[model samples]
Target: MKSLTLPAVLATALFALISPAIAQYADGQDATPEQAQAYQDAQGCILVLKAAGGDDNLQMAEQAMAKAKELAPINGDDTDEKFAKSMKDWEEILGLASVDESKQFLANCRETWSA
Candidate 1:
């Protein structure tokens, strides 16, 4: 039989790694102009995380997510990002690849700010 424990352990660690941002999304509610700016900052982190790749990249993505969550608001404030939580959700769903992919993703995200 396969060793389930090893996989379980790895999964646990992975969850723990992402828990911070997950917690932020759950506990964090509403948003401020500052939070919105913070999300904008996250756009940068995402690029680095996307390009950095590997475990380090995951960590960076988590960091960027935290920042994005910070800026994420329940309602639209100064930024039209809509919901920071949603953006974080989107980032995860987007399945970020390498730096180039991240650049494209961030560019699209940045458009929201420009328009």
Candidate 2:
């Protein structure tokens, strides 16, 4: 297979890094730094899976689901617990974002955290 040129590799890396910060999910106005980071990560996975499409999309979705199932439930201060639960919930849906219910997952993120 042909290798990617240095510029191509750099561009891809930059895009991948920035895509996560492109508002894939909303961090509530009151979210703490930790919560905000987790929220963004979950959003990144969701957005990535959505953009993957086709069979690859399903594969990405499955990996997300498996990772989520392995995570322990939230168990800490109110702040930690809230974000933990929120992250777990949003991320779990990410594994299915390329399937028929993909939009449902994104919708859940918006509806999940209403002001």
Candidate 3:
């Protein structure tokens, strides 16, 4: 039998909860600004987790990233601009964060994203 990782299991559960709303966006319907912002924030958290560089964190980051992308693809529209801004903002935040702050942020992300 295949073993599921914690991140994978959590992501599956989270997706089950949110997939209906995400599906409408994924199916070429317009995503609201709030949805776009949430996607960008999730991407930023995924990036931060990946940067943290532990095996478990990396796995979680990958799982979260996959779900975020699936839910809100940037299709050269307004979301593209929001995504760019989010990356820049998150990069700055990452640079400014101390190790402890990063850890706390990661912990919060794991809770928020279920990853």
Any runs in candidate 3 off by more than 4 Å, and if so which? 1-29, 74-89, 98-100
Model 2 C-alpha lDDT per residue in residues 1-115, reported as the tens digit of each score: 1111122322333343334333332433334434334434343344545565656555654554343333212212136465465455444444433554444443443333221
Best by TM-score: 3
Residue 111 in candidate 2, Cα distance off native in Å: 28
User: Model 1 segments beyond 4 Å from truth?
Assistant: 1-34, 74-115
Candidate 3 residues 3-107, lDDT tens each? 122233334333433454456567777665446545544665787778878887778788767656664554222375754654565566566566766666677
The TM-score that candidate 2 achieves is: 0.28
Task: Please give the lDDT score at residue 41 for candidate 3.
Answer: 48
Q: What 10-residue stretch in candidate 2 is worst by lDDT?
A: 1-10
RMSD to true structure for each model, in Å: 13.9, 13.8, 9.6
Give the winner by lDDT: 1 or 2. 1
**Model 3 Cα RMSD, 1 decimal:** 9.6
- Candidate 1 lDDT score at position 110: 39
TM-score of 1: 0.35
